[model samples]
Target: MSTSLKIYDTTLRDGTQGEGISFSVTDKLLIAQKLDQFGVDYIEGGFPGSNPRDISFFAEAKKLKLTHAKLAAFGATRRAGVKPEEDAQLRTLIESEMPVLTIVGKTWLMHVHEILRTTPEENLAMIEDSVRYLVAQGREVIYDAEHFFDGYLDNSDYALRTLEAAARGGASNLTLCETNGGKLVPEVHKIAAAAVARFGRDKVGVHCHNDSGLGVAVTLAGVDAGASLVQGTMNGYGERVGNANLVTLLPNLFLKMGRTANCAKNLKELRDLSLFFDELANLRPNPKAPFVGQSAFAHKGGLHANAAQKVARSYEHIDPALVGNRTRVLVSDMAGRTSLTLKARELGIELDERLPAMKGLIDELKEREFRGYEYEAADASFRLLIAKWLGQQKTFFDVENYRVIIERHNNQIWSEATVKLTVNGEAMHTVAEASGPVGALDKALRLALAKAYPQLQTMSLRDYKVRILESNQGAGSRTRVLIESGNGKKIWGTVGVSDNIIDASWEALRDSVEYMLMQS
Candidate 1:
């Protein structure tokens, strides 16, 4: 039988500890649901006793109807001089009603003697009492030996004693942790190999940090040494440098190690999972993250693109589509005719290599790009260019004029804007007031055309980004605005450039509205 490597996800617990990462209770439950859908064996929701948000999260997660993953509640072992039943933290873990309970405790001598301020023997007692109490209460317990590798290095027998304590107390899994994330892969494998020999391979698990950029490497090394279960945060989200990246680890385990997991069928959803999670957190997806990144399968070189178009494996490690991503031959100044043909095909543009229009389109793109028009980031603008040149764009609405004014009274500010629009030979004028200049302008424009274009109500700007183009005149530099808008089903981006910020914003907004109407 193939070895079954269990996947334990700690995104809600450990991931939130990373710098610049915070998720509301709703985000946590949503992420938990997504993780469960992706077929992870366990989801470490949060530390129930840590705070009110986590407590609420556990209460709500019960109603999410999660099917694939068992919910695990995390907390520390019972404190010194307290009975396991008397510890509030342990009680809170039970109250969360999670099927699995994971308790972390001091394993390193320095943490035991200096940080915990408890005797070595007392720490051992704490671990044993905490695990035995939970297991007796019908909880499947997993004992995390905090700083296990470091402790093993300092005092091998003492560290081994901690694992033994948990095992004796009925912990189903003895998870060795590289808490500080400074251990080398070889050191991790050696200690983990010894741990597997002593504890038996089926009982060992590995959790690691990314301080030295070797979290994933060391994690796989531990599995190579005999760990059957792996604990990591999605996208390697954790404190310090971060934890091991399960995005990279999962594929490595499946393809490289030949280990089978429940998530094998869901592996194709890995890219979408990474993107959706990052989007819920309102963070930009890392375009360069291994395997699932936007740039992972992007080919930029002319020679490389030509060869990839012929045979993908010739210039790539594996088929990008294997992980639900596709090969993208980037069209830039370095692009060849073959690459351009591929791009045109992707854009759904019927093209001919013998036609001079393709060459003309390339020249136009390069010229426009030289004047602060970046087609790479402003893909919507590039698409509009192609459609316009092909006579495929529809005429939406025309703007005759617009006016905006801001006035302050009694320490409060109000702005008003007037818009004059011509739609299909009908003239409409409207005025609106709002909290800011942009809001007032948007409201006025929408009011002018809402009667003719009812679909305007469904379109709203999702993101507006402005950049000041570099100029020798310094303060007189031009401004560029990119507006991302979405209807109920689809989203698109549009761009505008002008000397004034308001005009730039207005132009982009107009294009966005027109783009929506065109689709409707």
Candidate 2:
């Protein structure tokens, strides 16, 4: 029988520390419940004494009747001079009443002397007293030996003494941490093997960081060397370069190694789990992340797509459905007849082999791509391209003419935009004034379209990103604008490119309205 590994998730605690990520108490509770449903062994909610939100999250998590996972409250070990029983932080950690408690203690001599301004012996005493106090309070304590890898390399005897203190203090587990995240795979294996040899396998754990981009590799090396518990955050959110990403590590442990880890929850739900957090955090999901990314299974080369169609194992490592992703054949200039036919079939469009329109559309896409229009990132434009080629697109209104006026008056700027549009053979004109040219144009366009398409009023731009394509200097700098719009249930992205920002924004806005109408 394969041994089941423990999955310790720190998304609530460490993930929120990621730059620009903040979660409310309710958000923390939701993530905790979802992680429970996903079969994680433990959920580290947050450090209770660190912030008011975290303190509230601990109180809120206590009220939840979690079915499978144990909630862990996190905090630092006691101060150098104070006893664990006397330290307010340690007392607060106990008062949180979580079933599990994780306390980080200094392991590196540099941190002891420089950061903590304490003697090495005092640091060891803090670890010992904190673990004993938490354990004595009926809490399962996991002592995180912060900077254990570096500490071991610096002074093997002192690092070993720290682990011995936690063990002697009845800590349920001693987690070796890579604080700076610079340890290579070989160094990880060597240190982990030595720690296991000294502490025995059951008492050891691994907490990795990603500063050097080796978190995942180092984590795997730790497990291979004999770690019973692996600690990391989902999507690798943390202070600096982020913590180790367990989303990438779990599948490698369970699927690749064929080790049983009790992850009976739908492994296919990994993608949704990843994206759900991204949405809540108001961040764009990384498209290149392994297993759950948008392009994880996307195939583009003609030879690769043909091989993938024949036997997915030829080009793909495994079936994407195993992780709840579908194989995609991107339509681009490199797409051959086989790739095009597959794309059409997936879209429910039947194309005759000899259709001139099909070839013409492919040629147009190639020509446009060379001119700075990227269809891959702009699915709205790609869909419109297909609809136009099929003669199935409907234009609710035609824009006859538009002009933007910018004037400088008395050391201030004034802007006005006017749009003349024809809707169903009736002409309408609207004018709007704003602080800037782009805002004025948006107001005018919305006012003109609102009369005809009432649904357009419900839709708004959620995000707008601009990128310059060619940087050949002032006169000929080609620019592209990617606009993301939402109508609550679905999000659509459109792209527009031109020398003028107003023109690009107008093109993207026009596509947005058209896409919404198609949805309706």
RMSD of 1: 3.1
Instruction: Give the TM-score of each candidate.
Output: 0.88, 0.90
Task: Candidate 2: list runs displaced more than 4 Å.
Answer: 80-82, 110-125, 352-354, 407-415, 433-443, 449-452
lDDT of 1 by residue, 1-520 (tens): 3578889999899988998889999889889888989999999998886788998999998787878799999999999999999999999999989999999998899999899898999999999999999999899999999999999999999999999999999999999999999999999999999999999999999999999999999999999999999999988889988999999999889877888799977888899998887888778999898889988988876789889889889987877776788887666666656766776676666666666666777777667556665544455665666667667788877889999999999999999999998988899999999988878888998898899998899878778888899867587888888878788687777778887888988887787777667666
lDDT of 2 by residue, 290-384 (tens): 98899998888777888888999988886788777888877777877677666666556666657778777888888877777776667677788
* Top lDDT hit: 1
State the weakest 10-residue window (summed lDDT) of model 1. Answer: 371-380
**In model 1, what lDDT does residue 188 have?**
100
Backbone clash numbers for all candidates listed: 0, 0
Scored by lDDT, model 2 comes in at 0.86
Residue 29 of model 1 has an lDDT of: 85
